[model samples]
Target: MFSLATWNVNSVRMRLEHLLRWLKLRAPNVVCLQETKATDQEFPYTEINEAGYYVVHAGGKGRNGVAILSDKEPREVTIGFPDVDDQEAKERIIAATIEGVRVLSIYIPNGGSVGSDYFLYKLEFIYRLREYLDSYFDPDQDLLALCGDFNVAPEKIDVYDPELLAGHICFHERERTAIKLLKEWGLVDTYRALHPDEKGAFTWWDYQFGAFKANRGMRLDHIWVSRKLAQKLKKAIIDREPRGWKKPSDHAPVIAYFEL
Candidate 1:
């Protein structure tokens, strides 16, 4: 069995202790982290290495960042889209081939507001992701998993209150459509695949207004797998315990297990 987990830690440095504790508790075979909010220079490589995983990361200061941690060294690693020149966007994506499976840690931009330039960029990022897959992988053949904070809830069931949240930043129709197009390109939402009708299963909750206590949250984080890789899926879930811990990140970790 191989276990993979994705988390948007908000700020890695701030939550390093929690991360270390969870690492020991879960012991996932691979971990995909997003929103590390630390530049490569500031990343705590030594601490993470001491926890027993080799990490590959690309990041910027106090903003978007992504990383992949695995027990075994990756055969190959890529920091970003080969053709995309935007450094910030580059910092949001990182890929590594571990144990013959290609894994990607992605932090899709959380468009601040609907119809804003940043929102358009968020949609464009999804489009570029499709292009990236077209150029580098085959859904029918590749064993690949795309994991991290997507920042968009793909379905109504993914959000706490579908009607109330309609057109909201993360639940907007445009964002859902964009994510659908990416899924059409050959990715399966692993958690949804395993729990098609599950409701209120969210990975992110706003820190304000007692959102977590009210169970008002959205499933913005995910583990998407290609058809070939999806066939190996055994279990997928949102680990809410960490989010309940003291001073936790607004986002919880999503974990998936597979029979490899």
Candidate 2:
């Protein structure tokens, strides 16, 4: 069984200690990180390299970065949306193939709210991603995994209060449609696929308002696998342990295992 995890660390530099500790505890074969909030020059490559993994990052100066760290050096690493390099500036995505599995770590833009410009951008981003995935790889043939902070809750059961968060940024209808589009494209939500009837399983909690204590959190982060890889699905989990730690990121790690 090989394990892979996705985490939105908020800021890799600020959360390095937590990350290192988590790595020691879990030691997943591959990890996809979002919101590193650092430039390539500023990314802690030395520490990560010394930690016994090769790292690849698409990092910006102050916000929105994604990276992949793996026990094996990846083949064919790409930054941003494929075939759209000129408009690729936000460092929201980094993809690579490790051990024949094509994986993508992505940080979807927070829509802010309904009808906001950021919301539109978020929708566009998802649409383009669907196109890119379809163009670049065959879900039926290629072993693919798309993981990271999606920033969108796929269903009401994914949130603490469906009625309360109905029209919110993360649970809005338009945002969900975009997520559904991905499902239509053949990516399975590993957690939901494994925990169909489960609830109160969340990956993110607001730092304020004692959200974690009340368990008023939402499942914003995810690990999505293509049909080809989902066949080997062994386990999927939302690791909330780190969330209870000191100075933790608002987000927790989402992990999945596959028998290959």
What stretches of model 1 exceed 4 Å from their correct place? none
- Candidate 1 per-residue lDDT, tens place, 133-237, comes to 989899999999999999999998999899999989988999999899999979999999989999999999999999999999999999999999999999998
Candidate No. with top lDDT = 1
True-structure lDDT of candidate 1: 0.93
Model 1 residue 228 CA deviation (Å) reads 0.2
Question: RMSD to native for every prediction?
Answer: 0.8, 1.0
Look at candidate 2 and give me any clashing residue pairs. none
Q: Return the lDDT, model 2, position 180.
A: 92
Candidate number achieving the greatest TM-score relative to the actual structure: 1
Q: Candidate 2, which segments miss by more than 4 Å at Cα? A: 86-90
